[model samples]
Target: MNTRALSSIFTAELRLLVRNTAVAVSALLMPLVIGGMFVVSGLQQAPAAGWGFYVALMLLTVFGMSGCIAAAGTLTYRRDELYLKRLRCSEASDATILAGVLAPVVVVTVVQCLLMVVVTAVAAESLPANPVLLVAVIVFGTVCSVGLGMATTGFASSGEQAQTVATPVFFVLIGTAIWAATDLAEGLSTVQMLSPGGAVVQLTQLAYTGAPLSETASGALPALGGLVAWAVLGAGAAKRYFRWEPRH
Candidate 1:
């Protein structure tokens, strides 16, 4: 990492994030909204084992909405304002500039995650039994979300267009994960494992419930592999197709 340039770029991005109302709201407010929804919905007992199931589903739910919004909105704002173009003309390298642009999204994701855990622990009495596993899912999940957002920016023309461009993926990611984990979609059991948030939520739920998913390398390895693949795919797309300039 180019420390000095990265720091300056990060600082500049942070100021922009502070000024961006949607980014700020999604990072801070959306959690409260979802937390409220979860509490209202209530956590019913399932036959499933492990704390990972619940924690993973919950965190993924948070990520699907808030993380996507932050990523798309931030990218659109920067691209629209020619910020990415301007940065390219500066002393910052492409990699360093990209990192700085994503810093706020990463920070927001991490902080919101901590806040979610604390709130869930206090309010719902649902604690992450294995903090290590939870951290892994979170760190990986954030990376995937940021990368996905960057990839999605290829289609976004303006900040106002972010919500429309982001909604379909957001809905699919959250909806599929929730439906797969919950009893609602008992039919798709086989392929649910292939869903975007599938492995992450499965991994998280396992982390939370303290089940024996880890004992079976047969199952555990596949889920880990899937999440890793998604992360790589998302990052790869961003690297190949992410546009720093406005589309014609």
Candidate 2:
């Protein structure tokens, strides 16, 4: 990878992302709104799980879903405009180009996650039981989301249709997260544990409870495995189907 080329591309993408009003609102402001609502609903009075769960959910929702959609939107938009095609003709390698495009979303997600942590800590005195494990979860979630976003772009022929294709995916993830939070049938709960979004929520809930990795390894291991499987699957799909030029 050409470091200089990657840096330049990353800078440009970051600037464009920040300037887009819709992305700015969703990526930066939406989490704050949701967190505030949680606090107002008396989450602050509960134990670590209260604030911790809310914070983790917000991070995954904003950083994972919103960030993923933004990346997918940008990819499809660029393809429609032929920008991706033009970029491919440059000196940058394919991997470098992809890295550059993905960096901005990753950076945004990290910043938002940190901000949410600080807010949660100040409001509810909630902190991660295992900070290292939490970090790993965040990294895994981000990678899974980004790869899925890229793969989703393969189905979109234009920017408008990109929204159509991504919406169902967005809702399915949200639905799974909701189902994971509730008490459900034994069979359904097992299914949720096996899904990427559900696995992240389970791991986040575990982390929030301040349980040590050794103690929760039985649960945490499967969640981690699920995320890893999704990451691999999403990456493979993107590699096989992601398009640079617009489809005719």
Candidate 3:
């Protein structure tokens, strides 16, 4: 990989993200606002499992907005503007280009997630039982969201269209996460474990609840496998259909 090229692209993308007021607000500020609300709300006083629910919600919100939607919109804008085409002509490989473009989004999402964790912990007056597991979930979940975003870019013809196209995905993710967190669909536990959003929620709850990996392997393993499966599928879809320039 072209580290220098990758660095350059990442820096450029970061600058652009800052300049775009709408995207910046949606990806960065929204999480803080939502987390702040949680801190002051009655949810903070709920039992320990409720705190886990809050953390899971924060993760879902950030992943959906920053990692998935923002990535899709940014990539679509770049492609529409021929920015991606210019990058394709550079010495950087396709993988490096994609990484560079998506790196800022991924970094931002992870940071927001970590920040939410701290906020939730302080609000609930307790740190995560399994810090390592929580971090793992954050990292893997961010990657999965990015992969989904990349795939979304394949169908979005423009930046504006990207948002509309990504809405259903974002909602579905949030819905499944809620389902997993609430256990409303008890019989569908296996189905939930297989879904990307549900898997993330399941893992986040387990991490916060202090469940040991070995003890929770039956559920955790499926959740992890499900996340991996979604990530791989997203990557495959992006590889096949992603465009470097405008359709016209």
Best by TM-score: 3
TM-score of 1: 0.87
Every candidate's lDDT: 0.70, 0.71, 0.78
What's the CA error at residue 136 for candidate 2, in Å? 2.0
Q: Write the per-residue lDDT of candidate 1 for residues 101-208, one digit (tens) a residue.
A: 888778878877777777667766777665666787778777777787777878878886875676676677777777667742243243565566677666666566
Q: What are the models' TM-scores?
A: 0.87, 0.88, 0.91
Question: Can you give the lDDT of residue 72 in candidate 3?
Answer: 83
**Ten-residue segment with the worst summed lDDT in candidate 3?**
179-188
Q: How many backbone clashes does candidate 1 have?
A: 13
**Which consecutive 10 residues in model 1 have the weakest lDDT in total?**
183-192
Q: Point out the higher-scoring one by TM-score: 2 or 3.
A: 3
lDDT of 2 at 193: 72
lDDT of 2 by residue, 1-248 (tens): 99999999999988877786655555567656875776555463574334545655676666444566766777787788887788899999989988997788888877767776777778777777767667766787777777777877888887656655655655666567767767422322657877765776777777777778789778777777887787788688778878887876
In model 3, how large is the Cα lDDT of residue 66?
A: 86
User: For all the candidates, what are their Cα RMSDs to the real structure?
Assistant: 2.8, 2.6, 2.1
- RMSD (CA, Å), candidate 1 to true, equals 2.8
- Model 3 alpha-carbon miss at residue 73, Å: 0.9
Each candidate's number of clashing pairs is: 13, 0, 0
